[model samples]
Target: MFDYIIKNTSLPEVGVKNTIQLLNDACTIPFISRYRKEATGNLDEVQIGEIVKFKEQFETLEKRKATILKALEEQGVLTPELQQKVESAPDQTILEDLYLPYKKSRKTKADTAREQCLEPLAKIIMSQKTNDLESVAHRYIKGDLNSVDDALEGARHIIAEWINERTDVRNNIRYQLERFATITTKVVKKREAEDEAQKFRDYFDWSESLSHIPSHRLLAILRAENESFIRVKIEIDDDRALDKIFQRIIKSNNACSDQIEIAIKDAYKRLLLPSLSNEALQNAKEKADEAAITVFAKNLKQLLLGSPLGEKRVLAIDPGFRTGCKVVCLDAQGQLKHNETIYPHPPKNDSTGAIKKISTLAEAYKIEAIAIGNGTASRETEALIRRIRFKNDIQVFVVSEAGASIYSASKIARDEFPNYDVTVRGAVSIGRRLQDPLAELVKIDAKSIGIGQYQHDVDQTKLKTQLDTVVESCVNAVGVNLNTASKSLLSYVSGIGPKLAENIVNYRDEHGAFSSRTELKNVPRLGDKAFEQGSAFLRIKDAQNPLDDSAVHPESYHIVKSIAKNEGKRVSELIGNSSILKSIDLKVYCTDSTGLPTLQEIVKELEKPGLDIREQAKVFTFNQNIKTINDVQEGQLLPGIVNNITNFGAFVDIGIKESGLIHISNLSDGFVSDVNAHISLHEQVIVKVLEVDIPRKRIQLKLHK
Candidate 1:
């Protein structure tokens, strides 16, 4: 079944088996790749990620097929042949075509005419070789069908509508229309005053293949259309379309070829064209959404998996005016050490006091860093901190407080700091976020994280669904610390929710600590399914269960224990034993239900234990010297980090606030199309600067050849 699906679909060959196994085991893609490397040929995180997405899409298509088949079966129209065809349909589009006749719809003209007893005349006209179309019209020439011309017109209309309803005709026309369609976008010059229209001004007279337009450009055009600043219409060649349909009908009969031609043209102009155009538009929209969602997911994953600065003594300041700069100091473990309010900006302003407070706090606590919220007065506050110049060196940096206010008023924030004021909590969160971004950032909603494009414009429900999945994948990829993770973080765990997450936290609070991953079952509402999905992703470092310290699932514990016994050692000693593991007979313990496939996986994980799934690196601090495009020099070699990689190019972080583009052509001395083939995420590389545009903040680079 897995092989058949893989052959039928576009899934990559590298991780297909492991992906199928992961889906069956209910293990997430993150868990499988991070913990089961040997089982998956050591496929990198990205390839496995793609396989996971394909598996989900395949499952969704299967469910859709089942629903369609049942609907047809209940209608008593499901034949064995039809059922086989529907089941074997390759994609949702084909399945929908098979089910079109049975699918429910709103009132249509053909159905109304059939109700009026015009079916015989309509069928005769469709046959087109009857003694005469006039004779057929004579039978239905009554009431609304009065007069020969009226009757013929009604019959022709019915024939046209019937031809339109044919699934084959509709599908063929839709395909042709998509292939031949040109999306034309026009904007009214007068309505371009709105700030929203500025982005679309360059696209006012745009025309492109419906199938080839990029998602971002398509979305921009759609936004312009919605605002009425632009009128977009998809155009196709009518003659080619008419000829295609006419040939199909004409081949059947030569007697009424002209009548059929008229009918075909009418069907296309009135019925097929409009409906298929709408479908084409919808297809374009769906493709755009998928691409946009994929990009959004990738960016979200990177942002979530960003290297944590780790717990450090941090001084947080919410640079402000009316309330003064609210300051809070957190210890290395994020406990509030002290809090103070110093007026620095305006009104009861005292720069001296503010500087004194910050310096004193830095010196006394030996603060390693100061996190200043990037709000109205952040730069001013940073300047003040720089001037104060504490004797004990402290690095001050601006931190984006995009959702700081939202978190401050949130219930989780209140519960975490019941005694502290909202302002102080916000300040502390800002400071802590810089120290450990993944931990503190998880406290806020993923949507509020500021990584998406047109996030507000897209469907909120769909965006949330995709973004939530991304957050879950990222959170699970880097296994969360059971002791330190917040409920917000735990809630993203597969099979866990806000309520269950709270229950886990409360259970831990009441009891001392989670000694092992299996202890989660003790928490109320955490059932077998939740445990199966969430256990592999939650780590209890230095815990009682050695497997918990590693990513090996609880279900595989007995297998590892047996292996350990075979080696004449405890399970603890068996971990990290490559030679001993290779000597074991994996098939000896494999059962009919639990195949060797899963058993082999269990053995491989035991070889390398307690692997930290997250990227291994220290927190990266951008160089102060390279802060803008103007700061970059042509032909200068700069040490940088690869931020993103795509087929066409790579975006690198060169210590400038903005990332630079390294096109694939410039990536190496040899030919290269895929950026990933040469560069990877977080990989540090040296590149010679090629071009720099200060106004656009665009820097182009070529890799060191």
Candidate 2:
């Protein structure tokens, strides 16, 4: 397994071995990446993640090999040569091919022919050494054999099955599929004029090389096929495919060879084409799924790590037209202080009343910022709020309301605010999201947040697994506050799961806030291993020991103390003192187990204890003149925020109902391989409108340099 993983990942053998050992110990990825740097040779989370993926793949391959070997043995055909072939097969394709001939299935044409006593005739024809094939086949005129043609046809069916089972034939055709196959589609004739079919009109008559098709396009084509709007086919050049198979089976031009030729064509169509074509297409789909999942994971990570607004009193409004705007006031710690509703748009153009209510509420709650949900009536709400004069300057921000409704109806939301309805809950979510994105976003489903690409079309299990890993990485990267983090956020910490998180929260409720990291040991069910894994990622502000607030683990406090002792100062004094931190040689503290990587990390943590790696959230305003898509024009420069990214492009929210797309080509004049390399989620940027299709609600944009 180690050799297999090393071969696949091309990582250092020692690092791979140690990482596997740590994984065997059930250590979390974030913990191993951050705390076990010395043992892992300083591999990052991604590299360690690759090791984990390849290790699982190797295990799955071995399990499949074992299953195949057992099946072969049970069939009484487990020859030593066959056993060696199965054991040495590198991948699923080859291993399955080796077992294909012996696999049990529903009675096929070949099975019927074999039942008709045609096995000897097939072997005779396959040798292609006799000119009187029909004469030889006439001997099998027993059961179900009416004439010489029947005997020959039955023997041909057996021969076709044999030709299809050849490992070399399957491999050659698979190569052709992998290289030259084209995925073609045609609109389902009945569904051609339907409304849903129009969405995929571009794919109605589309054809692209399977190998060169983009991931997004392939996923789109597949989705179209799944919806019954299109008929999809995988094809390769027939003559080229047949020629390759014929070269391998045809040894002479005798009557037996002619019979074998007929069987070869039948095999190529009936057995080989369908089986290998589906395999090739499924492989392409899996690759496309992997690519799409990667894009979604990256987008989710960026959205999770978006800039935070810190602790501030906020007034949030979930904008609506006829339903009015749901308003909620939250304190600096994101606790809901007040909730109400105000009609500020259309039917109830009660601007005067709404302004008075907003101003009075802002003053009463001492609101420092306003977060307006960017939904229906969002522009009108922002305009109304901007007109009001407050005693203190309050920054107004338009927050994306994506997935807010999902959270509003969730059980977690009900647990947080039992008395408030979903509207109030949604408003509060918007306000809290501004205060700290990672903490609040973790409460909602990552998929529902609307930052992914082809999320539903990808493999759901793999998508969920990757998204969970991203969430965990983000949560650990920005250490959670021990006393204040919600159960959802706490659950994502290194080794703490939902149950442990709930227990920790319950313990905090029973007894006030924890004072230090050591107090975690007293929590129910939080054993030594959990504490060791999770303690460093949980921060405690104003703790008795300053190191508790920083990322420095408890096990390494002795090393920090040693450094302070050498500097002739207290541990607290050494904390954040750059001159003192810089003067200390990390090499002096390096022991056999504690290397420079660990010591260097400790010093860096001491410099900025419990520091936020994210930037502070800033207020953004869209064009006051452009309220809807109708106002947008070609070549118009506008400010927008990147909301979603894919392999092909980034979608920007340009202060309108419809977001504009900046295709990968428009990202820059130079070639761009990764969308994230050029733009990020939630990044404010200036863009030039390229085109707008009002009917389709689509807009094209180019990044403004």
Task: Write candidate 1's Cα lDDT for 420-447 as tens digits.
Answer: 8899999988888777677787788766
lDDT of each: 0.76, 0.93
Which candidate has the top score in lDDT? 2
Measured by TM-score, the strongest candidate is: 2
For each candidate, how many residue pairs have backbone atoms clashing (under 3 Å)?
Answer: 0, 0
TM-score, every prediction? 0.79, 0.99
Worst 10-residue stretch by lDDT in candidate 1?
A: 615-624
TM-score of 2: 0.99
Please state the error at residue 553 of candidate 2 in Å: 1.0
Looking at candidate 2, the ten consecutive residues that score lowest on lDDT are 131-140
